[model samples]
Target chain A: MIELQNVAMSYGGGDLFSEISLKLAPGSFHFLTGPSGAGKTTLLKLCYAELMPSAGHVSFMGRDVRTMGRDDIAALRGRIGVVHQDCQFLDHLSVAENVALPLTVARRPLDARELMELLGWVGLKAQADALPPQLSGGERQRAALARAVIMSPDVLLADEPTGNLDWDMSLRLLTLLVELNRMGKTVLIATHDLNLIRAAKQQVSARVLRIANRRLQLAGADL
Target chain B: MRAVLALIRADGRGVDRVVPPTGHTAWLTVLSAAAMAFLAVFALALALATGRLADRWSDALARSATIRISAPVDQMPTQTRAVLEVLATTPGIADYRALDEDEMRALLDPWFGPDLPVETLPLPQLIALTETAEGVDGEGLRLRLAAEAPGAVLDDHTRWRRPLVSAAERLRFLGLISLVLIGGATAGMITLAAQAALAANGQVIRVLRLVGARDSYIARAFVRRFTLRGLSGAALGTVLGMIAVALLPEADAAGGFLTGLGFEGAGWLWPMMIPPMAAAVAFAATRAAALRMLRGIR
Candidate 1:
């Protein structure tokens, strides 16, 4: 679980967001909606300890982010998975290798059959040997998703994971995320896609939080 | 010691496979190490040779002096006898012998040629003196000789020997300083190469960190690669240097100092240490660069 109390982030004397408090409990699903440059990605970065808040405290699993050392932060990252909007893969590696990178870095043994099954589930079994640059946009997104969930982390944070995909690919990726949430993994997705949020609400009880006027408000029954 | 063991243990762990292969920095590190190691071998050889030369000259000249009697042709015999009697009475004089005509001819043969007219040239009479462990006091011996044989001059070879010994010692010190400078240059070049590699692989580092890789783990990848490269390159350079030194013309009667600039006896084992030393330098340089670069990332 991640908790942020009265957190604020600024850049070069310009405030992006201020006085925000949010808590992500276990096995809960949430969608964050905001306009472009509304500090959505920045908030996700704060949650993963990639950036320290300018003024307040952010804690992961009951420990303050500022109090943890570099090694401790790395260990905490193992329990959380993140999917960036760009699907940042090492372009030289094959799709399957990129997907198994989390386990590789952790020094955990990888079962070839299990990796193959995971790739097949993401419909990337045929392109396992292909590099990231050779894959299509949708394929890259699915590959990033597979990589994110490979370690079976307790919490998943994604930033516009389906931004480049078509409707079918988006729904497919959403279903995979929904399946992961159903398996008791907490998921928080940042996006501005109203239709995707509407579609997600039909399958699960997802709370919507929108950023407007430099404040995070629980979205009413508008959507 | 632990660092060395870690390097060996992490050899085939596939830790280095995370970072993409770099082109220019790889060649740069290897070539710089090889070049510096080659120079270091020569420096090591020079230091050892100078040390040995200094010791040999010091030992040969320390306990010996020469007495030259320059006088009238007829009085030469009397002056030589007087110098001999004086040396025999000196307490620290172990032995003294008046050099005959043939022995004096041999001494001057290299400079004056073989068939010089030694009897007609009115050359000075020479006497060789060897001292005991507690050598003669030169001032006391000189005063005694001047009183007894005014033509006899005592030359303890101090003026000639001191400068030669000092020059040799200074040369040895210069060689050692050269070795130190070469080591420092090697470390600097490897650090630059490592920084370049880290800069070029920023994206790879970010991805690795995003997936929970510690800075130590990331640093190990670069350290192992650079260390192995340095070891291999230095080993090649050392072997080539040894071969080059061995192929030089051997020391002869004509080739005095230049030909004698090489390893002798157990000295050959010294250059074998260069490869390991280069590896250690590369390991330290690359590890420092990697850790500093990582700190700025997240």
Candidate 2:
């Protein structure tokens, strides 16, 4: 579980967000909604220790991010899968290889059967040999999802997971996140897409946190 | 050591997937390594050859002295006998013999023609003294020679020979310095290439880091790649250098000093170390560069 209390982030001469407190409990699903340039990505980066809170404390599993060493951060990252908005993949590597990258980075043995099964779960088994550029946007997102879950991470933090997907593809991706949560993995997704959030709520109950005016607030019954 | 072992062994499990190969940087590393190793070969050869030359000069000049007794033809025989008697009592003198007229002409044959009229020329009588390992005191021998044979001058070859020995020693020093500089340049070039590769593959590195890859894991990929390139290129360069050296006219007593500027006998084994050394330099350079770049990111 990741916790941030009274956290604030800033860049250059302006504050991105301030005095934010949030707790991502075990197996809890949350949707982080914010308009463009509202520090959703910055908040997610703080969860993974990619960016430190300028003020207050951000802790992962009861340890402060400020005190964690580089190696410790990497080890912590292995337990938390992050799906970027862009679905960054090594462009030169095949889709299958990219999905199996976490296992490679963690220096674990690659079971080809398990990798194929994971790819099959993401519906990308057929495009396993294709490069990232060769895959459709939906396929790339799925591949990124497959890569994120390859390690069976305890927590999954995704930024704009359905940003470029069609309605059906977004639903399918939401179903994957729902499936992961059902399998005891905590999930937090950052996006401005209210429809995707509404779609996800029916499958799995998710609290929505909205970032506005440099603060995070639980949304009212406006939905 | 354990960490190094881990880094090396991790490659076997295929960590290379993270940072995809950049062709231009790979070629740059190999080419720089080869060029550096080639220059290193020449530097090493120069050092070894000059070392041998210095040794030859030192050993040949250290124990010997020449006695020149110049006198009128009537007094030449008596002066030569007096110089010989004085040399016989010299403590470090192993052997002494007056050069015959024909021997002196042979020494002068390079300057004057071989058919020069040696008997009619008023050349001085030259006595060659081979000294013991302990070596004669030139000062003591010179004083004795002056008393016994006034026309005799003792030449220990130190005046002219000192400069030759110093030149050889300086050349050897310079060659070694050149070798060090070449190695340093190779490391610099490899570091730049590694940095460029890391920069070009920034997204790849970012993805890898996001997936929980440690710095060492990322660096090992580049280190193994650059190290292999360096080794292969340096191996080729070393072989080429050896061939070039081998083809140089073989040094012999007749071929003189110019021919001696290469490896002789067991000395050929020295150049074989260059490839491995270049590989080590590449490994260190790339690892440092990769680690530095990784630290800068995230």
lDDT, candidates in the order shown: 0.91, 0.89
Residue A32, model 1, lDDT = 93
Q: Give a tens-digit lDDT track for model 2, residues B1-298.
A: 3443344455343766566778798887777788888888889999999999999999998878798988999999999999988887879889889999889989999999899999998999999989998888888888988888899999989899999999999999999999999999988998898889888888888888899999988888888888778888899889888888878787875577767878988999999989988888888889999988888876
Docking class of 1: medium
Candidate 1, number of clashes: 0
lDDT of 2 by residue, A1-223 (tens): 8999999998997999999999999999999998899999999999999998899899999999899888999999899999999999988889999898888888788999999999999999999999999999999899999999999999999999999999999999999999999999999999999998888888888999999999999976653
Q: List the residue pairs that clash in candidate 2.
A: none
Residue B64 lDDT (model 1): 93
Which residue segments of model 2 deviate by more than 4 Å? B1-13
Model 1 quality (TM-score):
0.97
Model 1: lDDT of residue B176: 97
